[model samples]
Target: MPRFAANLSMMFNEVPFLDRFASARAAGFEGVEFLFPYEFPADELRKRLNGEGLTQALFNLPPGDWAKGERGMASLPGRQQEFRDSVKKALDYAATLNCRLLHCMAGLVPAEVSLTTATSVYAANLAWAAEQAVPAGVKLVIEPINHRDMPGYFLNTQAQGADIIAAIGSDRIGLQFDVYHVQVTEGDITKRMERYMPVIAHMQIADVPARNEPGTGEIGWSYVFHRMDELNYQGWVGCEYRPAGDTVAGLSWRERFAR
Candidate 1:
């Protein structure tokens, strides 16, 4: 069976960040993940986790100036220094939290930069990022975000993500397979999961067409869940979605899976 983690950034928006920890635990989540943790000190977040007896499953490296519309800096050329700085920062937090996985988002492909340049930079960045992550015992992950959801995103397909991981040639570098994004971009969820299971370190979920809790849209959640079990996906499956109603009330889907 797969372990489920509450995505504090998306699902538990009804409360303050600190309070979301307890809310997740109350809702029966054994682990949790969030978009970014730079706002509060790591110690404070740790206090909440220890209090709730929950584990920090995963989190992202800072996307450069998110408010300024930067998605991530990994693939952005001339930002190599900044990307390295971000990796060090991520390692610090991951070490402090004992979190073993970190998602590295590939930033938007700027119009002026050639795809060739961005590709080289992205591959080099991941190779370098892996050196730091491996020693820290943390795996660096790259997620294949869909173009429709993130219009200018550089990494947009499972094949592309797998290729990058293969090129980087490091066990420390892996894929953050978001089921919602993969279904939107590729449509072959089960096969892709099985095909990339060796390179996938973490996973996320949301129903298609709505990006809401499972079962709210077209995805056959039961099959997805059962398939992961059949494949023995021993990784965290993050609940990364918006709720259609009260957060707690939308948990029937999770309850059904927990059985």
Candidate 2:
């Protein structure tokens, strides 16, 4: 069976933290992912998840003061300490929540930084994260946001993400393949999925253009899901799209997956 997860950050925007898990479960998702989850107590979150029977498929390290426009600086030289600190905190949280994976945010890139420098920084940080995560039975996933959606972001391509994971060379270090980002950046979604499926640790989706529910945009989600099924992908397929109206109203297309 293909497990589906609702990204709380994208869906159920009106729900509170303590109640979001149930909302996601009520919305028919078997699991949930989030950008971050350090806002509340981990034990309490674990208890809530246990009660709701919702799995923590994915959650990210803090993006570091988004209000200051800091969209993560993990691969920057001077910010290494900040990146490690963020990872440490996230790992502690993941342990409490019994999460299987954690996304190590690769923040915005500086104009002066070379690609060599960025890749080296990311590889080094990921190698360290892999070392820390493997013992805890958690994988470290790095995402590639499309340039259009996140300009100057350090990691922005499936190939680039694969290279970074290859550099780290650990089972614990892998890619978070977001179909929405990859579709915007790379049009050949099926081929790219097939090519990187071996190294992809997580998957997320929405639609391009408006980033709404599946089937609302140019990407052929039916084909995409079919391809995923054909590949026998056992990981969670996360719904990481914005709701055009109310969350539930926008999720009616889920009936397509009822079979």
Candidate 3:
């Protein structure tokens, strides 16, 4: 079976953010990931993780003033300084939290910038991030979020993500391949997983059509787990989905896959 991490941001909304570490551990998760840790002080989050004996599996870098609808600024032309500053801040938190992977969101494209400019800026930003992350013992990752969940998201497909990785051409950065997003954008889930396994740094899970627990949708998670083993994917598979009902009650899929 694949090693699983509870996405505390989405998985344990029943409790406060800091308290979700204990909730996740109580529910048998060995690791945890979340959207952002910038709001919480690094020491405080580290204390909770130490108390629960959980590993910080993953988290995204600051996505530029999220409340204002700015998802990220990486691909934006003039915000390069802000983007680099976020990477440094994230590295500080990752060092304290012992998280090796940090995702950098490519915010939606601006109407003023051409696609070529955005792509060039994206690659340059990623190259700078890789330069920083390589020395910090962290991996910088980018994910292709399905456009349905995030319309106008700059990066919206594995092909696009792979291209970015290729352009950067560094080991310190990789793709955060969310199965649900791939399924939503492209149906060849397992084949794509295998095809891009080399550049895949971290993976996330959510069933398609509903973006809920596995059995609630059509994904054959059993086969996915078995295939992951066959392909030797040695990274955490994050449970980044909303629970259909209660958080813990909808964990029958975990029970089924927890070998």
Every model's TM-score: 0.98, 0.96, 0.97
Q: 26-84 in candidate 1: lDDT tens per residue?
A: 99999999999999999898899999999999999989999989999999999999999
Per-prediction CA RMSD (Å): 1.0, 1.4, 1.0
Runs in model 1 lying further than 4 Å from the true structure: none
Q: Clashes in model 1: which pairs?
A: none
lDDT of 3 by residue, 1-259 (tens): 7889999999888989999999999999999999998888999999999999999999999999899899998999999999999999999999999999998999999888899999989889989889999999998989998889898889988988888788777486798999999999988899999989989989999998899988888888888888899999999999999998899999888778645
Cα shift from native, residue 193, model 2 (Å): 0.6
lDDT of 2 by residue, 75-125 (tens): 887887888888889889999999989988888878999978987887788
Clashing pairs in 3: none
Question: What lDDT is reached at residue 150 by model 3?
Answer: 90
Ranked by lDDT from best down, the candidates are 1, 3, 2
Better of 1 and 2 by lDDT: 1
Position 227, candidate 3: lDDT: 88
Name the candidate, 2 or 3, with the larger TM-score value.
3
Candidate 2 Cα outliers beyond 4 Å, as residue runs: none
